[model samples]
Structure formats: C-alpha cells, structure tokens
Target: MKHNELKTKNELQEKSLFDKTVGRRSFLQYAGAGAAGIALVAAGCKKDRGYENPVMGGATLDFKDDFGVLNYAYALEQLEAAFYVKVASAPPASFTAAQKAYFQDIQFHEIAHREFFKAALSTAAIGSLEVDFSKIDFTSATSVLSTAMTFEDLGVAAYNGAGPRIKDGGYLLLAGKIVSVEARHAAYIRDLISNGSFADLNSLSAFGSNNAGGLDGALTPDKVLPLAQPFIKTKISAINL
Candidate 1:
C-alpha cells in the first residue's frame, strides 16, 4: 500500500467528529475489519517446534487503519512480555537481590500490558509471535539491563508517535496510561545502569531552551518496526506508519 494513500485516509478519518467519541464496540469493529484475511494467511504457516527452528514466517501487519496501530502496539508488548518473562524466570547471576525483585515487577507489568492489548483488540489481535533473542546473553547483567532499557524506551516512543493516529479518544487515553508506565520502566532501568541517568538528555531528547526538561522521543511505526524486527521472527512491515 502507498504510504501517502494510507496517511491521507487516516487523516480523513481523524477529521470526522464521530471518530473522536468512538466507543469500544465501534472501535473493535473498525479494528477487526481486516482480521479474517490476516488470520487466514497466518494459519497457513507451519509452526516451529523448538529453539533450533526459531525462525518462522508469519502474516505481516496491515497498517491500513487505527486497528493496525493497536495491533502494532500489541506486537511490541508481546515481544517485551516474552523477554521479561525469561529474565524474571532466570535472573542473571550477577544481579543483586534488589535487581531481581525489580525485574520481577517489570515482568508482571509487561505481562499485564500484553494481556490488556490482546483483550482490547479481541479478534483483531495478532496471533502469538515467535521471538529471536539469540543476540542477548541471558547470564549477563549488563546485557539484560541494557536490552530492558532499549525496549522500555522504544515502547514509550512508539506510543507517543502513534497517539495522534488513534482516532478513538478512549483508545488514545488507554495508550497514554500505558506509555506512562513504560516511561517509568525506562527510568528505572536507566538508573540501574547509571545512577541519575533516568531522564538523561541522550535518551530523553531536550527541547526548547537548555534549561527545559528533556522530552521523550517519538518514533513512527516505520522507524520502530525496524528496531524491533530483529527480536521478532514473525514478519512485520508497516510500509508506512
């Protein structure tokens, strides 16, 4: 699909006053419109059995509407939940008792976020994704904390970027709530690595005057998908956010 075409269509939809007050039922209806076709395509793919056969091709995300945006968030949440689950299950040997406890908390939060999106999207939600974490050293504290920071930061940016694309006020509000949590997670992880770097100018880019607080970065779907693609085995293409 043409990027400009989809953007124009989304803009037109956003311009409608009716879109702003869309209820849950109407939101699901709009989001689930393309679910059947995508599900059919996904069902045809063979599932992988174990770690050796990690990579498996799957349905690409259809970024045709607001549903697409929600699914995008759902996909990222799935990846994060899976990662944190693994970490919490077997924390790095070098991690302190406090670190282990903090990681467990993060794991639960990510799981909650993942399940919430799944329920919100309902039939429109994508199937379970296959993840590839081969590059991460599970036994290394540095590796684990660094990756957590990356995911949390990316998640905050993703929601910020996608907020305007969500036509339904309810969905946007929910996204805001979730992103705030993600931002907190990012801060915690950052502080774990380097004290007082939670809202550092590097991760949270500064705006306005030098004295002004740093603003978190926002990344459109096109930008976020590439950074996240490596950790996911399933194929995902936004073409254009």
Candidate 2:
C-alpha cells in the first residue's frame, strides 16, 4: 500500500482504540484547558531539568509546562517515525519477509503516535524535527535493527522518566498508553536481535533496573535529550523544563 494509505489505515485503528478506551473528545478535554498549568504546578517545586548544548542549533523545544513534556515526547515520536518510515520504505535485503512486514506495521504505529501528539498539542506542539541517520546503514539488517533497538529503548526511557512530572491524570494516562506500546516494540526488536533475549537481563536493564525487580528506567529530559540529540539535527531547547 502507499504511504498515505497506510497512515490512514493505522490512524483509523488508533482512533478506534482511543474511542473504545477513552473517547478522543474526552481525552483531549483532559489534555487540553489548564492541563499545562496543572503540570507546571505539580512539578513547580523541583529544580529545572532542561538542557542545552552548543551543538544543538535548530528547532527549539519550548517546554512551557506539561505541554513541554508532551512536546518532548512529540519530538521523540518524530524521530522514531522518521527512522521507521525510512526503513519500511526500503528494508534491508538481509531482513526476512516477516521482518519487513513487522517494520511496516511499526512504521504505521509510530506515525500514528507522532500524529496523535501533534493533534493533541495543536498550537502548543513543536514543529516537525529533522533527523540524521547518516551513520545507520539501512541496507544492512544488523545496522538497521540495532539502531531501531536503540531508538525504542530510548523512547521507553524518555516516557518513563517524564511520567512523574505530568500532573494531569489525563495526560498521565496518555503517556502510559504510548509508553506501553514503546515497550512492546522494544521487546520485539530485542528478540529480533537475539531470540529469547526479549526478557533477558540486558533487556530489563534498558528500563534502568539492574536487579530482578525488572523496573523500567525513567530518564529525565536532560538525560534523554542528549542521547536523542545525536540523531536529531534540531536544536531542542528545554531551558524552561
């Protein structure tokens, strides 16, 4: 199917799920209005965790409050979406037919996630970000899948770490839903890298838990942005975070 057609199909599926669980209107209501202030108020006492670097010099992420956090997520989604779209557009020759299909499905899902954030944030959302994948060898299965694994792991951590700062229950719920999907993608990619390694120690460690408790790691924005910055050419300013 064509890119636009695939995106539409996936969006319908996401909307259906959203409607069944929590109507889009209701979800937006929760995420809209004073949600940003509430998030700010909730995390007001904490020291700012925004980041900056001389190398980062492009689209800035003006994180005003919880909207800032959401925008951070939006930015990450943009990166992941871009990466998957590129891979799905022309998967590695070494990748099996099933793997190619999986990448396509993941591409749709990431695009849906990216679009959802853009719509939810509306005027508050950041612009689309430019990504640098020059280091990734798209024609090689090991290169592509490894890079995918890295992105998925970082995404899961970014959401987990930012969860506490989200004061609004509605926004929190939104983050929870998206992060779960990210974790699933991480596990799938892990297995693709090495069978039965999905739940292994290294995989669990990605969540920041080195112990048997299997807790997922929550990386603060300062930490996440640096790791993500390498792939993104946009200069993300989280000074207000």
Q: What is the C-alpha RMSD of each candidate to the true structure, in Å?
A: 10.1, 12.9
Give residue 97's error in model 2 in angstroms: 1.1
Highest TM-score, which number?
Answer: 2
Total residue pair clashes for candidate 2: 3
**Tens-digit per-residue lDDT, 1-241, candidate 1:** 4656655554454344124212212222323324343233223211211122233567467766677888888889889988987898899999999898778667656655665565555556678788989999999999999899889888988898888888877668768877887888898999999999876756455211121545677887877888998998888766444
Best by lDDT: 2
Per-candidate TM-scores read: 0.73, 0.75
Lowest summed lDDT across 10 adjacent residues in model 1 is found at 44-53
lDDT, residue 130, candidate 2: 69
lDDT by residue (1-241, candidate 2, tens digit) is 6545544554454454454322223233323324343233223212211221223346566555566787789889888988987898799998898898778767656665766676556555676676889999999999999999899989988999899887757678878988987888898999999998877655556457555666777788888898898898777767766
Off by over 4 Å in 2: 1-57, 203-207
